[model samples]
Target: MKLYQVRKGQFVFYKNELHKVYSVKPMFRQSVHLYRLKDMEQILTRAADIELYRPKHNDTFIFYGQRYTIDQYKKPEPGDYILITKPAPDLFDHYSLNEIEKVEEVHENSVTTTKDNGVKHHEYVMLVPGKSEASQEIAYYDKELVPEEQRLKDESISYLAEKDVTLQPYVGDIYLDKRNNTKAMVVAVTESEVTFGHGIHVHIAELLDEESFELIYRYSTD
Candidate 1:
C-alpha cells in the first residue's frame, strides 16, 4: 500500500471520486472519518412527504410520521401507526375509557368495548420496566404469546407476494392428507406451529411457503 500524507481541502481518491481527507489521525482509521454531519435541508433539493420505508418488526408499520408499534389496532395517536398482530382484537385493544363510564355501577373489575369511532393518538405506551421476578415472568410469557413463527410466515408471504413469486401455503392445512381434507379450515396459527385441530400442528418448514400459506399437512395421522 502506498502511504500519502493528507492535507485539508486536498481531494484524494477513495472508492470512486476524490474525497478530501480533512482529519488524518496517526492511529485508528475511524478517527480519520470522511463524512461530516450536516443539516438535512442542505442534502435534499425537493421535499417529499411519502417515505419509502420498511419496519424492523412484523407488528410495526410506518405511518403518518412515525412507526407505531402495537400488538393490535384500536386507537392510534399522532405519528402512531396501526398493526395487525393478533387474529382478532386482543383484550387490551378492546378496552377503552368509554366502556368504563359506568364503573361506579358495575361491581366487576374488568369491562371491555369495541372501539367503533376511531383510535385516539398517543405517542407511546409507557410500560413499567419489569420490577420483580413475577413481572419478568409476565414479560417473558407475553413475548412467547406473540406467536412469532406465524408472524414470521406472514412477513415472508408478504415479501414473496411483493416479488410475484409462486408461493405455497402451510402443510398442516389440518394435518391434511386425502382423508380429512374436507373438514379443514385454518383453525389458528401459533408461534413455531399451526393448529388445525385440538391434536394437530405443523412446523414452519413443513408449510410450502412459511410466508404465504395455502395449505397445511398434519404432523400425525392417528
Candidate 2:
C-alpha cells in the first residue's frame, strides 16, 4: 500500500505477520517523501495453518516433517521453532488464500526473566482465542520486554483527578489495568465500583487512585 494510504488502526503485513498500525509519522519535505510506522509489536499468532503435536511417554510425533520420540508429555512454548517438512492437511491444500480467516484478537500477558546480575527482561504471551481448550497454545510472543515507546501511555491519577475522572461507567470507555497490561471496557459501574465486560470489578478508589490503574479515555466504536 502507498504511504498515504496507511492509517492508524489498519492492519499491515509486518515481519511476515499481521501487525496493527498504532501510529504513523509522515515526513513530507518535497512530496510525501517518507514516513515512520509504529505498531503494536505483538499480534495474535495464527494457528490455523500450523500443526501441533503433544507426545505421550515414549510416543512418537511428527513435526513439520520430522519424526521424534518423546519420553513424556511435553508442551511447546511461544518461541520454539518447528521445522515443517510434512505435507499440509487436506483442509489447507484446497482452500484459497483469501478464504482463510485470520485471528484478530490476541490477549497479552507477561513473564519476567532475571539475569544473574539482577537485570530483568520481560516476555509477553499472545493467546489466540476461538480454538478448543486442548488445542489452544501460546500462538505468539514478544521475545523481550517492549520498549517504553511501544507501550500505551497511561494517564496519571493526579491528571485523572484533575480532570474529575469518575467511575461513571459508560459503554465503549477503555480502561487500562497496568498490573496485567490488559484493557477492558466499562460495561457497568455502581457508585462504589466499576465493572468491565470481562466481569472484572474494581473499587472506585482503586480505579481512580491506584497507580496500577489508568483512565486511557472514553471511546465509542459507534
Candidate 3:
C-alpha cells in the first residue's frame, strides 16, 4: 500500500519522510524547521525510501511483504529497522526502541582486514528525542524545558542549565550515581548554591529520583 500523512487529505510522501507540518504549528517552508511525531532517525533515517504509516493500536506495520508490530520493529541500526511503539519499562513514560532485535546482512568482501575486526557495515543509532526543527534548529541541553526554543525535543531536564541553578526532574533521563550503573531518582540538582532536603521545595525532576536516582519507566538497551 502507498504511504501518506495522517491528516485529512492525500499525503504524497512529502516533508522528507520523517518531518511534517502539524495542524496547529506554523507553515512549513524550505527554511522552516520540521519535527516528526516520533524520532524516525532512530530507525529508517538512512533508508533511501523511508516509508511509514502508523497502525492503529492493534494493527501491524507491513514492510517488504512482512508484517511487524511496533514492538518487533525495534531492531538495532545498520542491520535492520527499528521502530518505537512503547516506552522503557524502567524509565518513566519514555518511549523506546529495543536495540536487541538487530539482524545484519554483511558480505565477506565488505571487510578488508585479515583479523575479524568488530567492524561491520552497519549503523549504530540510538535515537533520543531532539529539540530542533531543521529550519528552527534548537537544542535543550539544560534542565528546564523550553517549548519555544526547541522544535521537537526529548523531555530531558538539566539541573545544570542557566534557567534554574537547582535542576528539576526531567521525564526521560537517568539519574546516575558515581558508578553510572547504580542509579537513583535525581530528585534535585543544584549548581553550587542550592541546598536540598525535606525542609525545602525542590525541582520536580530532582524529586522523582530521590530514593534511587532511578526513575520507574520502560526502555530497551541492546
TM-score of each: 0.18, 0.24, 0.18
Candidate 1's C-alpha lDDT? 0.27
CA lDDT, candidate 1, residue 135: 24
lDDT tens digits, residue span 1-23, model 1:
22344332222223221122334
Clash totals in order: 17, 5, 31
Worst 10-residue stretch by lDDT in candidate 3?
109-118
User: Could you give candidate 3's per-residue lDDT for residues 1-222 as a string of tens digits?
Assistant: 233333311111223332322222124322222233223111112212323333322222222112233322122333343332232333222212221122233354221111111223232222222212221221212214445443222322331243433333433334443213444432344432112222122223222223313444423343
Candidate with best lDDT: 2
Give the C-alpha miss distance for residue 9 in model 1, angstroms: 62
Q: What is the lDDT of residue 110 in candidate 3?
A: 25
Query: What would the per-residue lDDT of candidate 2 be over residues 79-189, giving only the tens digit for each residue?
Result: 221111111323212111111111212223221111001101111112221233244211112313444433222113333334444444466788787655688787876
When 1 and 2 are scored with TM-score, the better candidate is 2
Q: Which stretches in model 3 have alpha-carbon errors above 4 Å?
A: 1-72, 77-160, 168-208, 214-222
Best by TM-score: 2
